[model samples]
Target: MPLSAALLQTLHSIVGDKGFTTNQGEIAPYLQESRNRFQGHCDILIRPKNTQEVAEVLAICNDENIPVVPQGGNTGHCGGAVPQGGILLNLSRLNKIRQLDGLNATITVDAGCILQNVQLTADKADLYFPLSLAAEGSCQIGGNLATNAGGIHVLRYGNMRDLTLGLEVVLPDGQIWDGLRALRKDNTGYDLKHLFIGSEGTLGVITGAVLKLFPKPKARACAFVASESPGHLMDVFAYMRDYFGEQLCAFEMMPRFGLDLVLKHITGTTDPFAIAYQWYGVLEISTSRPNTNLQTELEEALHPLFDRGYIQNAVVAQDLMQAEKIWALRESMSEAQKREGGSVKHDISVPVSHIPDFLAETSHAVCNVVPGSRICAFGHVGDGNIHFNISQPETMEKAAFLTNWEALNEIVHEMAEKYEGSFSAEHGVGQLKINEMDRFRGGVELDSMRLIKRAFDPNNIMNPGKVVKI
Candidate 1:
């Protein structure tokens, strides 16, 4: 159903001329995601400046039964923010830092504040915000909270759900729920904040949040280690986890194929090791105490792993610059795959011990189905989230390879399920993996999700056709 002129005019009145745009050119960017895999259409794009404006706009949309797609910074890998029809309610204009209590170790801000800006604000106060990712410079806090984003540092500091203390949301009926409490132990009934955190906008619009902060690390050390295979790397990870304990911040793994792609496509990046190995691991350890020689400690720790033959070769970064260079090899893997050709990506997770067997069996299964496909699997193995991405064959066309996306996804998702793992780990269930929810998560689990969706949004006007189908 098309939005009536009266409904559009009423929405315009709530936001005014500067906050609304019907121009197709201006609205083009908001209708598509960063990956360009999903594109949608909206009659008008509405940028609400504050929480009250957002409430008013949503209230009107709710009354008219109009579909409203709430978009954050639009950096999501899944198509969560892509608008289907009706109004595109963007939260970019709501950017503001409401409060910063350094002593309490919390920062309160509007949901539209850029993630990097929050990190910088915390840095200025000599504090730290540990939720970091590739899209931190552009992705908004609301989207991060909505998707419960997980980055490399999840091994130590938890994901966005753990970082968030409280949230202020505007429901589908335009009623504002003020649950923004910064208490560490709030045994209040039914922690409502969790409902919207990973709900992916199916419940309500996240307007503002109070996020937790941590002590900034005074010393840091990182190393890139080469191993014969993922199985060997897991042994190394186990030893390091016990040795470093709380000091261990990150542990990432990638195949040789992933590194080759980065070295070939990304400029000014050099291989950390002289000889290439089958698999590589990046481990980082940090301490809040100043003047700690983490580099020496990390170097001394690798000696035992070498003795055990768990690692083939290793390069411990002596300086900050070298550490970043080592991290670049792991961070740039996704971008490097794009330069090759069509890549079928999967954000899946399994038990830490099951990672090796899962990778080996899944790789074999994928290869059997799509012969000659290049498997570029990598991610935060410390937290058990692996980005299993497959690139097109050298001899195949990009379009032809992309057609195997669903088929390859089934094989990978089935393998993940067999290992008692989740198919969608960090990425939320947008339109992309809604069917997976039904296939993998059915009966009581899926039925409960639908019951909550209908209760919160009976009209289904809040991000309709997302997360759970009604």
Candidate 2:
């Protein structure tokens, strides 16, 4: 709905000159989705300085039936942050470390606080906040919590939903719901924070949150192991987890093709192993205690893989720099993939035990549908999530290869459903997978979701046409 002249004047009065902008040049960055796949437009973009200003703006928009798109750092991949019209609520100015209870292992931060900054704050206090993502440097806590972002450390620390304990939200009607309790166990009527956590801003605007923290790991060890197959890598993973326990913070899998892409496209990237192997698994074991000898524990546990012929070789990082370099290969996969052209990325997960079977079947099915499609499959296999991305065939045109997005999504999602997996794993429905929510989610599930959305946002002024359609 277009903002009335009176409404625009009133909004301008509420935020003042520094807070509001109608200039397209200044608003250009906030209008684009991360992949350049979804481009949205807005009449005005407002940078609210505090919760009161946010509430005031939301109240005006809600009263006028104007949609409000609450955005963080605009680093989301699924177009959740993209605004169609009405007001774009830019929360970057609201970034402030509200509180920190190091003794209790809890850190309270504003919605727009950059994730990397939060990590550093925790580190400064001799604690750790484990909600790490690739775009952590720019991705805001609000977006991370809204999407319930899953990252490399999910296997050890859980997702954003788990890391978050409480949230302060600006409701659809402009009322601030302060549920930021720092308690570990609360037998409340309902877990309201979880609703807004993964709601993708459809329910309400997440203004602030109290996140859980953990003791910083003092002893750390990393290994880059080569496996003949994913199943074999899982075998080694099982053994390592049994021996290393909670110290196994990360277990990332990378295909040879993925590594090759990084080596070719990204400068200063060197092969961890002398000879390229079919599959590579990067493992990191760490503990708060010093002199844990996690390296030996990981090494001994991996010895059986050779006898089973699952793993052929392994390289343990002797220093911090080498460990980082080894990790760079895994972290560089997505950027390197961009150079390959017309990539169809899937952030899907199956049961930890079923990963090998799912990969084998899904790769076969994807190949059947798009023959010669170069598969660049990798991700956190310890937690069952797989970044099953496919790059376009070298011979195909970029536009021509992208034409298979729909067919390819169906094939991959159907296979995941057969194995009781999600079509959209960590990345929220946003605009990308809203249609799939209907195709995959049960009727009762969809109905329940809509019912909740209606109960909270009957007018649907908050983030319209995203997540679930009412």
Candidate 3:
């Protein structure tokens, strides 16, 4: 149902003319999702200036039983940010670095603060906010907290869910829950902040967050290593981690197919290795101590793996520019896939030990199902999260290839389930994986989630029909 005239006017009043918009042109960007898989419609987009304004909007929304989709930078892979109806609560105006406690190693910021801005602020303070993703430049910290986003540094610093210390949220009934305590340890009742973080705004709108910060790394070593086969990455990663330990930040894998896709499609990319290899991976080690010879450490550690015939060829980035160039190959996976054609992607996780076998088996299975289907498998192998993306067969029609989405999802997700891995890893369930909740996740686990959703959002006015169903 369309919002009543009075209700719309009230929402407009809640946020001044500058903060509210009914025009389709201005509202179009909010509806155009990151993946472009879904485009949502909202008659009005409300941009609240502060937590009080957000609470006021929610009070009106809850009373009218209006569905509100809380949106951040709208750079999420899942369509969780996209609203079905009701006015969208655009939190971009709330962007502000509220506080930065360098001594305590915490930074408090409004939810609308762009992730890169926070990172830049942390850098200025000689500290680090390690939750780094490709869309950091555009994505917001609130959405990151809401989705519990995981990026390359998850192996070291943990996901946004782990990095966050506290959250201030507006409840479904318009009550502002100020739980933003920047404490390392607080045994004060149940941790309510967790309910909103990674909740995908189904329960409440994340207004602000107190995020944990880490010591700035003085030096980071990067390398692009080639494995004889996909199966060898497990042994290779083990050798590197055993040597580097907590200093190891990331270990990402991209197949030759994925590399070729980037080379063929993207500009200014070069082949780091002299010969083409079947499987390629980028491993990084970071340390806070200054003048640490990470290159010498890498050389000493690589000799053993090289002698064992596990490593095919490798090149450590000589400088900052070279390091970024090496890292670019990994970051360009998604963009290159888009340039190629339709991609059916999976952000799933298995045991670190099972990654090699997982890639080999799943890739073979998918290719068999759809002949000529190019597999562009890559992502954070250090923590077992693989972005197993399958590009449509070049010869096949895009529409026809897309029809196999369910079939392909079944093949990939089923194998992940069989391997005791999660079907949805970093990317939350959102609308895309809602059905998978029943198929992969069931019984008591799902029951508890539903009960909590009903408890916090009894009316289900907050981000309805996204993560869970009643």
Model 3 residue runs over 4 Å out of place are none
Ordered list by lDDT, greatest first: 1, 3, 2
Residue 280 of candidate 3: its Cα lDDT? 88
Across 170-287, the per-residue lDDT of candidate 2 in tens digits comes to: 9988999999999999998998998999999999999999999999998888999998899899988998888778888999999999999999999999997788789999999889
TM-score per candidate, chains pooled? 0.99, 0.98, 0.98
Candidate 1 lDDT over residue span 1-470, tens digit each: 76778877888898999899899999998888888989999889999899999999888889889888898999988899998888899999999999999999999999999999999999999999999899899999999998999998999999998999899999999999998899889997999999999998989999999999999999999999999989999999999999999999999999999999999999989998788899999999999999899999999999999999999999999998999999999999999999988999999999989999999899999989889999999999999999999999898899999999999999999999999999999988898998999999999999999999999999999888888778
* Candidate 1 collision pairs: none
Ranked candidates (TM-score, high to low): 1, 3, 2
Residue 220's lDDT in candidate 3: 86
User: How well is each residue in 241-307 modelled by candidate 3, as lDDT tens digits?
Assistant: 8888999999899999999988988899999977899998899999999988887787677788788
> Which structure among the candidates has the greatest TM-score?
1
All models: lDDT? Answer: 0.93, 0.89, 0.90
Q: Give stretches of model 1 more than 4 Å off.
A: none
